[model samples]
Target: MNLLDENNRHPTAITDNSAYDGEPTWSPDGRWLAFASNRTGSGEIYITPLEGGVARQITHHPAWDENPSWSPDRDNPRIAFVSSRDGHFAVYVIDLAFVPGAGLPAERRVSPLEYTAFDPSWSADGRTLIFAASLRGHSEIYAIDIDAAPSADGYAMRPLTDGLIDRQQPAWWP
Candidate 1:
């Protein structure tokens, strides 16, 4: 993978891409990067400090995980990514605070089981999460409040768009 400075100039190779590595997301402080790689045979999320530190694997699931989205909360960073652990690709949220040998960090499934979701993006407030999912039909962007109580039928996913218009990777405005 490569890292570029502001204005998208001066590209620098950050990692030796011996394995498939992609979907890089930067921490709020811009000191570290979180990306998915298949270095260990199965796709997993890993974070590497920009200052010559080794990359540490944050996720260790048998199924592949990808598309990591770091939270804007500098105080307590979190990663939201998609995984195929449950047979279908679903979104899961895990804390970015991974101790070198603390084992797998705690994570929770954020999307409903019925639909396959992808491209998780955090809201500016870090209180809501949005992703693209299709329920046996065309994909649509859906948002869910992470801290809000679950609704009667489970997570209250609010659809941001409707009809046949497709959308993916929703971003938040300041």
Candidate 2:
């Protein structure tokens, strides 16, 4: 991926690898970037310092994990991403504050198992996540309260738009 200035000039390569890396999201502090890369063969979440260095793999899964969205809260540097590890696309959140190899930080599945959720964006307060999902034969936007405890099936989710037209990518305003 390339980073460009406000004028869309002087684009600099953020990830100049040949690993099909895309969907980059900047952290709240703008010091780091979180993106999805297939460098390890399967798509996994990776974080790299904006200054430059080796990118660290966050999610080491065989299934595709893409569309990473960093929380807006600087204190809670958590990442919300889409993963297909459960045989279906779902939204998951991981705490970046936790050490990488520390017994695998608790991964919370924010979306339910029945739906295909993707392109997650965090609320301004970082307490909710908004994403697009296939529901009732059409794509729609849904919001879930991640701060609340999820039930056995998943977290409490609500649709934001009617299932009239397809809505793929959702961007939450600050």
Candidate 3:
């Protein structure tokens, strides 16, 4: 991964090591960058400081975990990502405020396992997340309120776009 200036000149390498590193997402404070990498085998979430340092692996699962979207709130640091740990693609959120002694952070599946959700984007307030998912035989954008506790089935999600056309990679304005 590389960082480029506003002018798109003098791009600096962020991850110099050899690995499939991509899908970089900057932290709310811009001090750290969260991205997906296959350094340790399957794709997993990793965080590297912008000031330069060794990248820390945040997620450890046999399945693939990619497409990280950091919460916009600095006080409540969280990362919404796409994971296939449950046998199906789904959106999961990890609370970055807590660091466990071992294993990955406690993940909350924001999207149901039945649907394939990816390309998660966070709302400006960090209270909601928008992503693309396959529902009703078509791919469409959806938004879910992450501020509330997950219901019995999972986090409540609603379609943002009609099923008339396929949509992917929903981005929210800063």
Candidate 4:
């Protein structure tokens, strides 16, 4: 998983030996690279260096952890991703600065604690995130303001699409 520079020099293997790997994201500072791999017998997110080195696992579970989106804030280095640890697929987030790896601290499930959510895309403002979820048994798009503290009931998720053809992939306009 070695990444090349602009000059196509300084090649290195990001992962020593991994069966699957994809969705690599560089930190805002461009110091580290985060990606998903199934090397531990189950798909999990891991972070490595663009300069080449052993990767660090960021999620641990029998379920799959895929599609990592790094926060634009470099100090915190938060990562947003999807996971199936709760039987149903949902989105989650973790702070790389405080949580060194998958085992540093428990991963935070940022999606609706009760609803199924997946494929999260960050908003340009970095205070919001867009993801796909089911409401009233109908799949649609949703947006949440992470900056606002979630009520005890749970975080707020507003539907963006009506009950009709599924809106597969969603991205906020630049």
Off by over 4 Å in 3: 6-8, 101-103
In candidate 1, stretches whose alpha carbon ends up further than 4 angstroms from where it belongs are: 5-11, 97-102
- Which of 1 and 4 is ahead in lDDT? 1
**Model 1 weakest lDDT span, ten residues long:** 95-104
Off by over 4 Å in 4: 2-12, 100-106, 136-138
**Total clashes for model 3:** 0
Clashes of each: 0, 0, 0, 0
TM-scores for the candidates = 0.89, 0.88, 0.90, 0.84
lDDT for each candidate structure: 0.88, 0.87, 0.88, 0.78
lDDT of predicted model 3: 0.88
| Per-residue accuracy of model 1 over 5-88 as CA lDDT, tens digit each | 878699888788689889999999999999999999999999999987789898889999999999988876899999999999
Give per-residue CA lDDT, model 4, range 126-146, as digits (tens): 778888886456568888877
* lDDT (10s digit) by residue, model 2, range 97-118: 7765665655778887888898
Candidate 3's displacement at residue 37, Å, is 0.7
- Give Cα distance to truth, residue 47, candidate 4, Å: 0.5
Task: Indicate whether candidate 1 or candidate 2 has the larger lDDT.
Answer: 1
Question: Ranking by TM-score, best first?
Answer: 3, 1, 2, 4
Q: In candidate 4, which residue pairs get closer than 3 Å at backbone N, Cα or C atoms, i.e. clash? A: none
Candidate 2's TM-score: 0.88
In model 2, the Cα lDDT at residue 167 comes to 91
